[model samples]
Target: MTPRIHGGTDALGPARWDFSSNANACGPCPLALQAVQQADATRYPDPSYTRLRAALADLHGVEAARVLPAASASEAIQRLTAWRARAGDRRVWTPPHAYGDYAHAASAWGLERVAGPALAQLVWLCDPGSPLGQGESGAAVQAALEGDARTGVLDCAYAPLRLRGASALDPAQRDCVWQLWSPNKALGLTGVRAAYAIAPRGSEAAVAALQALAPSWPIGAHGQALLLAWAQPAVQDWVAASRTTLAAWAQDLRALLARHGWACAPSDTAFGCARPPRPLDATALRARGVKLRDATSFGLQGWWRLSAQQPPALAALDEALQEQEREAVR
Candidate 1:
């Protein structure tokens, strides 16, 4: 089996100044944090996750039966892929640059990648896509809606944390596809694994298929608490406020990188891809307590994905780049 590539704190343990993962830089949200800290681990969560699912449904203004909970977005992706594979769907379509787990899960289920949304049996779309934070084209979304694909999933992991711009999909278009939400990234609780999907309006059959493939009690006590907290007004308020901070930080970080001669791609969200004026020795920088995501996995060679972080983290990165430049000159 091929290994999966991802960002965030990796096998090397956490970096002092992590620019790898695109999780909210201003979090973990205090309210959500309290909920996680207060979670009761003494017993298992409800097998059906009735209340939890209902709360998530209410948040998205969907019917309770339309919500499908998973251990994480990756788990949701895998289960959905498995469901499509079992139904004899063999082709998958993905955006040019997207989260790796889409392709990884598709490959695991023997689904081949096909060009164009209209040609595939299963299609994946990420609005404010990963590694770039750019929204998908509205025309392409309309095309996917009109395609013959059996299932289409829109990963909304970054949607909550989107710093700017509007979604390409309108309300009706969004209802035509699976909308996956992993609030952990927005809440800065990525360590807590839990995610849920809102099935397309009237997608009972698809919901049933996904539930059948999922293990019982997909979310644990902590995950339940985190998600429950996520539905609270106070938590939503916090997330909204954090975006203001992230926007400022993102602008500052971009300017800093530009001053250092890095070329950055324009982004609508808090994270983006950039290329250093010169090649960077990533491993050496990691050793210096800073880590950046190599965008190679996202198919952007010679570029790196950077999450907008606070001044301290940005300062560390600036110093590390300077050190690398000195070493290169030597």
Candidate 2:
């Protein structure tokens, strides 16, 4: 199978200005950072993850039984897909532009992609979606919720980092679908791998099924620490404050790209897609200590996903793009 592509730090090492991964530009939150730093790696975490599960459950106002832990959001996707496949689900549906892992996991489990949610046995939804960073349509979400699909998971990875707009799903609707959260992004601790899911109301059987498929000790010491920090009131407060900074940075980045004749797509979150006046040489950019996510992997050819960053990073990008333009004109 072909390797899946992702953003953030990559094989080329970190970039000077990385508009690739959509982690909160204003994070890693100090509180969460301190928690991870202090996590003791000498012992195994509680195998049952009782305390961690309870903390996540309390954060979502759900019962502990409804909270399912995973090594990361990507692992959650794969495990959930594997469980659904084992349960006889043979088809999946996904948004037009979504995180690639959804399709990758589905394909790994022999699930074929169908054009619509109504026709698939499993469906994936990303609110304030990846690449585009836009909210999914209400009609589509309703269709997925009310459809005959055996399972539906809404990736809320970017929800806490949303710079504008409310979730498309109401509380009632939200209760009907699985909600997956990866706090590493919100805490600006993407290096830490940890995520959890709130199974839909009355999904005890499904949760149990997924648990059976998961390996023992899905989360590690540091992962546990990061998640516990994520549930704290002070950490959440920091996340909320970070959004204001991100909103301003996103605006500045968008304006900067627009000035360079890039077509910026509308987004409700801290990142979005933009198409430059000319094709970008990703390798060349990387060599210049700048990197951008090629949107082709997210199903958008000739477009790029740009994550909001501080002014210094944005300025570096500006210089890089200018240099590229100068060379192209030569």
113-152 per-residue lDDT for model 1 (tens digits): 9988778888888998898999987655866787555577
Candidate 2 C-alpha lDDT tens digits along 235-328: 9999999999998999999999999999999999889999999988889889888888999987799999999999889989999899989999
- How big is the RMSD of model 1? 1.1
Candidate 1: 10-residue stretch with minimal lDDT: 142-151
**Clashing pairs in model 2, backbone N/Cα/C closer than 3 A:** none
**What lDDT does the true structure give each of the candidates?**
0.90, 0.89
List where candidate 2 sits over 4 angstroms from the true fold.
147-149
Clash-forming residue pairs, model 1: none
Please provide TM-scores, in order, for all candidate models, with all chains considered together: 0.98, 0.98
